[model samples]
Target: MTYIVAYIASLIVFGALDAIWLTTMTSRIYRPVLGDILLSDLRIAPALAFYLLYPVGLVVFAAMPALRSGSAGTALAHGALFGLIAYATYDLTNYATLRSWTLQITLIDLAYGTAVAGLTALAAYQAARWVAG
Candidate 1:
């Protein structure tokens, strides 16, 4: 029950923030750098899957620990760490395999992921505590 609430809260908050970042910020920032490699039309399926699935990782790795400890700080720290690792995995793999991938983009993405996940986890943990009470 609580876990479900936490998951939903994390998903909603993170998804919204990520959407805003993608539409308003990242598109402009990356378009110039990625240029031709940037798809004009986004593939909805993978984007949707990423939003839906990524929250599960947050719930399990960050929210759960914070809930158990009754500490939002725990969520923030763990969530940031989780984000760093997860984003690094994607970006580093791209850097390794994709000729078009850049260190600038990878660094920017890693920073964004870390902040977004940490903040989302904090919000989710707080929401769960509110719901539990």
Candidate 2:
């Protein structure tokens, strides 16, 4: 039950951050002619990312046997991996929609991805700790 609560709480918090990050970051690169459509869709990214996390969460769960083994760093690493994956997938899908994928542009994209991962991972770690307790 605690685990469930933690996961849910983390998802909400991280989800909001994800949306904020996406809207702000993307706006700098490409202004969507769809107006509010991007914001609406951005909200969905968190849940989408979380869904991806399910498989990774299984790994996290399995590692639970190590109990005292993992740290926030571990979560961050996992989250970073998720972010990179998300970035690649997103970039590929939106390439046509984007203006240009310059080096600076790519770096910015990566920054946003990293931000999402780090923030979410931290939230998840804290929530997990609370839940585990």
Candidate 3:
């Protein structure tokens, strides 16, 4: 329960930071800041919001383990796997949505997934150690 809550809170913080970075730094060809919610014409289902929790949780979980093991090789491999899982979860869940239709969107999602995996893994591992010690 604590892990789940931690995942949710961490994800919200990370996601918002990501949004801010994207909005401020990225091109308009991508998304203008947090414009995804605004620009999408498709209707979002209530159940779909639940999908948010898994990707974030998986990334954090996988990353923490790999990083705590203190092997860069392990971190990279596991992080990539975590990223793939997160991407799959995201893509599969949004199949009905129009955002899932484009090549650019898919690539962008892949990048984000990989980043989340790598970053969360390292951060969670260090954080856990810090808290324990």
Highest lDDT: give the candidate number.
1
Spell out the clash pairs found in candidate 1. Answer: none
Runs with alpha carbons beyond 4 Å of true place in candidate 3: 1-9, 21-27, 30-52, 67-77, 92-100
lDDT of 2 by residue, 4-41 (tens): 55466556766677667656766665554434434444
How many Å off is the CA of 45 in candidate 3? 8.7
Query: Where does candidate 2 clash, by residue pair?
Result: none
The global C-alpha lDDT for each of the candidates, from Candidate 1 onward, is: 0.90, 0.57, 0.56
lDDT of 1: 0.90
lDDT score for residue 55 of model 3: 39
Model 2: lDDT to the true structure: 0.57
Tell me how candidate 3 scores on lDDT: 0.56
TM-score for all predictions?
0.94, 0.61, 0.56
Candidate 1: list runs displaced more than 4 Å. none
Clashing pairs in 3: 23-33, 63-121
